[model samples]
Target: MFKKAFFAGIPVAILCLGLLTGSCQSTGTNKRDKEGFTAIFDGKTLQGWEGDPTYWRVEEGALVGEITPTTLLKTNSFIIWKGGTPADFEFKGSFRITTDGNTGINYRSEQLTDIPFALKGYQADIDGKIRYTGQNYEERGRTTLAYRGEKVTVNTQQNAADPESFRANVKNNAWQARQVTGSLGSSDSLQTFIKSNDWNDFHLIIKGNRLLHYVNGKLMSDVTDNDTVNRKMQGLLGVQVHVGPPMKVQYRNLRIKQL
Candidate 1:
């Protein structure tokens, strides 16, 4: 009777172990699928990215880009992600920049083989000076499409006579600005939301020709691109280490979900 009882218990123990392993695997998958986003950075290495090793690396679980005075670039360089090109998606990340550092998240961009890791397209600007931070900029293209706290509708057919004309058009439509309320009254108010030398959360949402940039949970810029002639629908994604001064920018918790 004792031998029969011990043999029967072995099968029960095996079944319990299998159930525990299956439960753990399911939990991990659910955690990664939270909010329908997947992490782009592994927090260990630059395995799925392409860039000059001299300027980009993983440090302390963050993707770090640094340029010393001795290694100043003649033109902006980027670390391009080799992952799939996302047409419509939401990107979320946390960043910290030095006082002299200038960086950006470039999306829907194209690479320039002539310049070695050079990218040109839409850039969600980031700067330590707080001047261009939270703006929608086109790299090597149309330049600043929208500034902080401005809601802009770009009519590619309407050619402005000068820079002032373009600025006037954007401001005239200020009443249409999205996500401006309470603490986020104006562009200056948005600037106050930035932490400067400390970490700040950035969110970029793009669907079709519309783009929105948010910093620290505040909407900083809104753009509706009507430039069908030159606008990009899809391209590469990259992070920039701008040319000039010794500076460092660190990014972590990078994730995106294609919509």
Candidate 2:
């Protein structure tokens, strides 16, 4: 009887060992899926960022920027990330804003010498009213590259004698270089996905000359920039508080994965 019982237990022990090995493999695969991403914000302090102290701070685990009734801004200010210039990358974050807030995330940008913490490049625009949220606005650059719910391609004018002259002449008119390739959805319908006065997930996939923006897992804008003179391939990254009425904007969970 003892010999028979011992022989039967051997099969059960082998089956238990196989199950444990399978569980360990699954955990390792999950870690591998999240391997490349690097968190930019520490969530407790502004260690790797710079901006005007009067308007920017770390509050309740979020990077907060506010313009009070007394502290109105003369011009737009930005809190720039000191991390390496990411050329081809994926960026992810979340934001919440007041009803009248105007803020944006600037990437592939040049820092202005005249104004402290001023940047000019592509912006992922956000507003409390959701009017311009998810639009691609070039901050102090070519203005609107791709509005919400649109896919656009930017081409330089071949016959223009001067590229700088051409850019300045059509600063407000992006139609000169932009061609609508397709539509993602209606702007009003996309707005329904965003949360008012609550945190919403935002993502940007920028590779080569193509840039894509998404909000709450929905594609918001797409742009294929072929303009060599005006478009930037790599530069600094920052978040902005626009020059407007008293408003507040907060950002959290900032991370990047370089491609």
Candidate 3:
């Protein structure tokens, strides 16, 4: 009878161990399994965002934007997120662009009725040609605040005081040439990190006046905006469908963490 009891207990213990293993593996499909980030895309519908139906849709578990020759845009367009305007946050998503397409992730932006579904503010530049991926650009504002592989501090006051002197000081320095400083690796190195025409991860971390952009885990640009008069503190978020040659761009696995 004792031997029989021991064998019965062995089976119960095995079942308990299997149940524990199954529980440990059921963490959902969200990327990174990050502890605090919230998913913004439901992967099935455009429930929380707004954009021109002509250019945006949900396809194959991704948010897709396509523009054909007949659907050419008169001006740039965006799919604005209706979620609360984030002041400080970390945003991440996977993106892919066709050879002729260009897109950007716009944040801290405002919608303008002048151009329907248009957004104006900071943009994380993305292009199929890999020319501007992972850079900081301001839509309809102070464009190209920081380029790939740059660490910049924008001080409009100093730049305005002595334009010629400032230009000369940072002449050979790519970062300072933009009236900003440099950090991380060189632009050439950044280009190597970007995978053109393929799915790649883009990330943005924004806290107050400081912003950081990354591509595929490589630091692309960092900026500290000192232009208090023009720098935006917070606003809407959107993705762009640049007005140019016909093409397509797809985005997936979007998540954000408010800081």
Q: What is the TM-score of each candidate against the true structure?
A: 0.79, 0.84, 0.80
Sorting all predicted structures by TM-score, with the top scorer first, yields 2, 3, 1
The TM-score of candidate 3 is 0.80
The clash count of every prediction, one per candidate, is 0, 0, 0
Clashing pairs in 3: none
Question: In model 1, how large is the Cα lDDT of residue 61?
Answer: 94
Name the runs in model 2 displaced over 4 angstroms.
1-35, 158-164, 167-175
Q: How many pairs of residues collide in model 3? A: 0
Per-residue error for 194 in candidate 3, Å, reads 1.2
Question: Measured by TM-score, how close is model 1 to the native structure?
Answer: 0.79
Candidate 3 per-residue C-alpha lDDT over 29-112 given as tens digits, one digit per residue, 9 for 90 to 100? 322254556566778887778777888889999999999988888789888877557788889889999988999999999989
Per-residue C-alpha lDDT of model 1 across residues 61-154, encoded as one tens digit per residue: 9999999867778888788877656678889999999999999999999998677778999999999999889988888766777778777776
**What TM-score should be assigned to candidate 2?**
0.84
Estimate the lDDT of model 1: 0.75
- Return whichever of 1 and 3 wins on TM-score: 3
Per-model lDDT: 0.75, 0.81, 0.77
Winner by TM-score: 2
- By the TM-score metric, which is better: model 2 or model 3? 2
